[model samples]
Target: MDSNLLRVPDGSESVTDADEEIFLVYTALNQKPTDQIGPDGFRGLGHVDSRKDIISIRFELTALSHPTSSLSKVAEDNLASKSRKGKSARRTCNHADAPQTIEIELAQDKTALRSRKGDTGSVLWRASIAFAQVILQQHQFPQSNPLFDKDLLRKSHILELGAGTGLLSIALSALAKSYTATDIAPLLPLIRKNVALNFTGWTYNTRLQEGSPGSNICVEELDWETLLSLPPARRSHYYPKPAEPNAEWDLVLIVDCIYHPSLLPALVETIETVCTAAKTWVLVIVELRQEDVVREFLERWLSKGTWQLFRVEGLLELPYVIWAGQKGVP
Candidate 1:
């Protein structure tokens, strides 16, 4: 269980109405500190008890599998088949082998899942899994981590840019107070499908350790091209607008979002808009598909001289690079 979900309460007296809704639901589900015991013999925290009852049903299908460095023989064969057919090569994220044993009922039409040539947004990416793993790690050690701010993540209005497969966003919904997952318009269908698939109707309300049901997760269309094309004054309107009026993003999660150099400019601009706010934080997971492209983005990013960037060390051996940063000088 993640204590981060239980770590921050009220999170300052200036809590917005949306935050109040999340906190109220969290309190209702988890219950207050009391001197009562439950019928199951264990005491306090109804959600924890709920976990005891649910573990048997939901986790039975989940297998404790480690991340794989190589694709399975079957995926390799699929790659070879696509190559032989002269079809554009697909970008296959390691999630195909990662711990997806939780039984998400995706569409049976496997053909539809295939990624089109030159468009990686339609497919999963390794950094998405890495980002989720990082979240779990922070939840495990909320106090020690220098890379991310626990309070910002726990109670803030959060957004995930290019939330491919909605993997990170799904995991985030259970942790963050309010999470909005965004991708291109066409991918919204697939993202929503994955959301519904992982979080069934009956279990959706009960899944998160915190946050109100329904308010915990939202899916929306956010295109970097379209957003960047908008006028400077109008670009803010393109952001994933929170239902709570006047809400600004406190944390932004970007997973494997920077690969193409052409999209880098817009992506960086979008990041600046979100992070320039006084207290916002951005956690980016880049899979370094191209060193030149990655370097270009880093250089462009540094040129602004605004963000105080921190490259998350020790994750170098992993499939992706983790970056945590916040705006400088407020």
Candidate 2:
């Protein structure tokens, strides 16, 4: 990892520059070969020998989007706090107490996005990209099949839970009839920004055949744990008031959200509530970590018999499991 990638601003402590740099390095090293080239030039050699029938390998790294000038001002404000005083302040001056700053490239893919240091509050998880690609592959959009096939992509209302940067939802929205992306309140602005950045100058009419309906995509604030707990009137406060009451989603997407042991039950409950009316398909994308927490959670769901889980095949460049679910109850 490059040490310069880890330099934080002068005074911010919420996230260290080192943290950003380390995350960037890990993401870059782990991305699929199609995504980026390795720092050492081992091009797309996944468990294969270097001398094996070597086709021409191309090395291309995505450009990182620089943060706006305003970020520097925010960094200054976060670093220049005069709260420290007296003897304790002197003890804290041993470098650890200084504010840390990291320069981040905005809107880069998962790999480059991790190197950003700021209070953006958006958490980028590698599993999300893996799952998103899986979903795209399953539907065969912008690749094998046509764009707006009603049988495959259209008329499917998709909802992305905890959509940190709304990447998956953005792709789905481009293919599906409608998409609703949600996350915690803190992440809404960043999600919207990402959506705008990717969708700018995007023309779907040319891609789709004549008479195919366009996609409708919107970002909203939805705390999954509290979604169904709210009263009908209160629900409107969080979600937009649908013109009709039967506007249920056809699919629900969640990525890297089941890590916490306690969160699984709440997450399942939230999925059950939101997916009540429609014959919904739930797509969960998760990465296998050292801990068995995720595996245990899946087992609990399996024992209940309310849901069916199938692990979809993934690409060599991505480390993700695609667990797809259908209507388990009626």
Candidate 3:
């Protein structure tokens, strides 16, 4: 790791100081790196069986695993407080401290789940698992992590783009007030199925039907190419509506979504459209499977002057790099 990659702009800077924003870049390692690299790396990679028709994964939140870490006493107390407050106090079980477990059922071998023309997104990707762990670490240790803002998950509206299996959204849905997982039309059912596997109450569209309680997660279609064609006035029709008419999404999650170079522009455009407001943050996590695709994605993001990029540290090891891009100053 290069020492320069750790650099980031001061968070206290005013919105007017846009010129002072700096970009921290990290080149993915050509060789495969295992979870042995650090506690933050992907842990269950060795045990994953991609050949199965349906795969299930259980992850114990990293924030509660370490007794010596900052979350030790804090998590115990939080769990106790949640117990005292009763079921009404709990937002989602994922945020609770008692070894949060999210069981995601993935459709790896389904032909109907794939994108049109038979593309990826039907299977579970390794980066999404690493991403879930990283989110927990960042939320607990915001002072140390540059990319994540602890406040964003506190009753904030979160949207996930290209949410393949909706694993990441389901894993962290408890923390947000409302979470929308969007992908192509073909893969919407797969995401909805996976969401249903873990959560009790959820919807397939923006409108929340009555009787659906205990879950704030929803699955919808958000095609990047289609988003690019729509005008700014009509674009709002495609995006998932926040609870309030004036409310904007606080965070956008993009995990392992970048792969093909042809779709890079549409993806970047979609990011820009959603993150047009100030203080909106987008976390882009990509596996270093294709160098050209990753490079082009970064280049397009950087070309957009309003977006500032920061390289997230300690969340993932080589072959995986998560970039936190904010639309404007903190």
Worst 10 residues of 1 by lDDT: 53-62
| Model 3: per-residue Cα lDDT at residue 260 | 80
Stretches of candidate 1 off by over 4 Å are 1-117, 140-143, 146-152, 202-215
Better structure of 2 and 3 per lDDT: 3
Ranking by TM-score: 3, 1, 2
Residue range 141-176, candidate 1, lDDT tens digits: 343332335654566778888875676665556566
Off by over 4 Å in 3: 1-48, 62-100, 113-118, 137-152, 201-214
- Overall lDDT per candidate, in order of appearance: 0.51, 0.45, 0.60
Model 2 per-residue lDDT tens digits across residues 1-330 = 111111112321221232342354346446656333321333322121112111111111111211111111111122113222111101112243232221111232233234544212254444443344333433432223221233544656777887866656654565666677887776776666555444443232223233232236667777755765776465544543222256666667787676667566656656656663325667666554423565555655554456544443322133344455654565
Model 2 lDDT, residue 6, Cα: 14
Ten consecutive residues with minimal summed lDDT in candidate 3? 69-78
Top of the candidates by TM-score: 3
Once fitted onto the true fold, the runs of candidate 2 whose alpha carbons sit more than 4 angstroms away are 1-121, 134-150, 201-215, 228-245, 314-318
